[model samples]
Target: MGKIIRWISWLSIDVVLGAVAGMLFFSKLFHVALPWQPYVLLGMAVWCIYNLDHLLDAQKVGEKLSGRRQFHHQARVPVLIVIGILGLLGLVGGFWWFGWGLELQWTFLLGGLIGGIRFLVLKFGKGWMKEFSIALFYVIGISWLPFLRSNSLDWSAWHGLFFLLYLLLANLNLLILSFLDQEEDQLAGFFSVSQELNTVSLILWIKYLMYGLLILLILVLVIIPSFYKLFVAILFLMTLCHWYVFNMDGVDSEKKRIGMEWAFFLPVLLIFLK
Candidate 1:
C-alpha cells in the first residue's frame, strides 16, 4: 500500500486527476469538449513542476542524507530530463490546442506565469502568500484551459460558482499539505500559514473551510439540482478528510497527500450517474 501510494506521488498521477477534473468542469458546464492536448499540457506541467518542488525539498532537507533526500538527489538528473521532455511536449500541445489564436495563448501564458510566481514565492516568501499563490495558480492551471476556448471571457453563474467551490477545495488541499510540511518549512526558513497558526487556531480554520464547503453543498442542494449528486459526494469525502486530518492520517504525510489526490476522482460519479 505504501509503495503504491509512493509511486503515485512520485509519478505525480495525483495532479493528473486534478487536471482531468478541471477539464470535466469545463465540459460539463460549458458543453465544450476540450481536446486531449490541454489535458496533457496541464498534467505534464503539474508533473514536471511538482517533482521540481520535491527536488528542492530534498536539497533543503539539508546534510542529513535521509532516504528521501538521497533518492531525490540521485534522481535529479532523470527528473530534469523528464521535465525538459514535458516542457517540449507542452509547447507542441499549446500550438495544437490553441492554434494561432491570441486569447488562448494569453491565457496559457498567464497560467504559466502564475505557476512561476508561486515557485518563486515558495522559495522566498512566507505565510499565507505562498498558500494563496499555490491555490490561485492551481485554479488557473486547470480552469484556464477550459476558459481559453470559451465563446466569451465572461463566465456564467454556474461557472463562477464551480470556480469558487473548486478554489476552496484546492485551498483546503494545499493547507493540509502545508500543515504537514510546516516543520520542514521552518527548518528551511520558509514561512507557511500552518507555521503561524496555533493548532487550535488551525483547527478552527479547518472547520471554517469544511463548513464553507458544506454550505456550498447545501447551495447545490437547493440551487444546482443537476450537480446535487456531485456536490454531495464532494461533501461526504470532504467530511471524511476533515476527520482523517486530526485523527487518522496526520502522521503519514505521503499517504495523506495521496488520499487528497484520490479525492479528485470523486467527480467521476457524475459520469456514472449520467
Candidate 2:
C-alpha cells in the first residue's frame, strides 16, 4: 500500500485528486454548482503540468537523482505521451464547455501565457518565483469556476481570506518539499529556490511560514462566516499535517513528500461536512 501510494504521488495522480477536492470544497462554500467539465479540465491540466515539470527535471538532472526524479527519468516517454494527450483534451474541452465569455477568454489567455512562461523559466531560468507561481496557479485553477459561478468579481474580506489561506497552504507544501529535497536537488545539479538559502536559513523560512499560516488560520476562523469556518478548519488541519511532516526527524524525503501530497486531500472532508 505504501509503494502504491508513492507511485500515485510520483505519477501526480494524488495532486489531481487534491485539486478536485479543493474545487469541491470551495464550490460548496460559495454555493456554486460546478459541473463535470471544470473538474475534468482542472484535473487534466494539473496532471499535464506536473508530469511535464517532472519530465523536464528528469531530462535535465545529472545521473544522481532522487527516487521521484529517477522514476521520471525512466518513464519520460510514457509520461510525456500522457501529458500531451491530456493537455490537448484540456484545451479543446475547456473551450467547448466554458463558452466564449470575457471571463473565460481572459482566464484561458492568462493561464496559457503564464503556464508557458513558467515552463520556460523552470527549464532555463532561476527558481526564485517558482514555488509561489505554482501555488498561485494551483489556487486559481481550483477556484476559478467557483469565483465565476458565484458571479461576484468583487471579493469580500472573507473571500480574500479564504483565498489567501489556500495559497498559503499550497506554498507551504512546496517550500517544505523544496527544503527536504535540497540535498537531492543539489546532488542532481538541479536548481531550486532552496539553492539560494543555507540549511539554517531554509529551516528558519519554513518555521516562519508555519507561524504565518497558523496566524492566517486563526484570522480565518474568526473572520470567515460560520458556513465556511468548517472548511477553513479542515484547511487548517491540512496545514498542521504538513508542518508536522516537515518537522519530522529521520524520515526520508520521499515519505515526507508523500505525506504532504496526501495532506492536500484532507479538504475532501468538507464535502461530507457540507
Candidate 3:
C-alpha cells in the first residue's frame, strides 16, 4: 500500500486529481457548466508537466537522485513515450473539444506559452524561480477555465482575491516540499528556495507563509459570497494540514510530501457537497 501510494504520488496522479478537483470546485462555485474535455485535458497536461520536471531532474543528478527522481530516472524512456503520446492527444483533442473561439484559442496559447517557459526554467534556471513558476502556472491552469466561463468579465476584485489565496497555498506547498527535500536536493546539487536560505530562515519563511495564508483565507471567506465560502474553507483546512505535515517529527520528507499532496485533494469533497 505504501509503495502504491508513493508510486501514485511519484507519477503525479495525485496532483492531476487535485487539479481536477480544484477546477471543478471553481466551475461549480461560478455556476458554470464545464464539459468533461477540460477536466481530461487539464489532467493530462499536469501529469506531463510534473513527470517531465521529475525526468529532467533525474537525468541531471547521478547518484543523488531522490527516491521519486530515481524512479523517474529508471523509467525515463517509458515516461517520455507516454508523455509524448499524451501531449499529442491533448493537442488534437483540445482543438476538437474546445472549438476555436478566440477566447479558447487565446487560453490555449497562453497556457502553452507559460508551460514552455516553465519547462525552460526547470532545465536552465534554479532557486526560487522554479517553485514560484510552477505554483503560478498550476493555479492558472486550474482556475482559468472557470474564470473564463464566469459571468463577470470585468475581472472583479473578489476573483483576484480567490486566485491569490490559491496561488499562495500552492506556493506554500512547494516551499514545504523544497524544505523537506533540502538535504537530498543539496546532495544532488540542485538549487531551490531552501538552498537560498539557512535552515532557520527557511523555517521562518514557511511559518510566515502559513500565517499569511491563514489570514487571507479568513478574509476571503468573509468577503466572498456564501457560494464561494466552502472553497475558502477547504483551503483553510489544506493550510492546516500543511502546517501539521511540516511539523511532524520522525517523519521523512517523502511521507510529508505525500501528506501535503493528499491535502490538495480536499477540494474533491466539494463534489459531494454539490
- TM-scores, all candidates, are 0.84, 0.91, 0.92
Q: What does candidate 1's lDDT look like per residue over 85-186, in tens digits? A: 988987777777678698566876786687688778867776777777877777766777567667674556767767777778777877777776666666
Better of 1 and 2 by lDDT: 2
Q: Per-residue alpha-carbon lDDT of model 2 for 1-274, expressed as tens digits?
A: 9989889989999999999989987888677888888888888988888888888888888346777878999888888888888888877897788778876887878788887977787787767577888888889888878887785654567777788889988888888888888888777766687777878887888889898888778886896677777987898899899888887899988888888888888878866777
Backbone collision tally, model 3: 0
Q: Model 3, 1-274: lDDT tens per residue?
A: 9999999999999999989988987787667889998999999989998899889888998445578888988999999999999999988887887778876788868877996897788678767887898789889889888888888854567667778888999999998888888888777777688768878898898899999889878887887877678878988999999989988999988898999998988988977886
Q: Which segments of model 3 are wrong by more than 4 Å?
A: 115-126, 153-155
Q: List lDDT for all candidates, in order.
A: 0.69, 0.83, 0.86
- TM-score of model number 2: 0.91
lDDT of 1: 0.69
The lowest-lDDT stretch of 10 consecutive residues in candidate 2 is 151-160
The residue pairs that clash in candidate 2, if any, are none
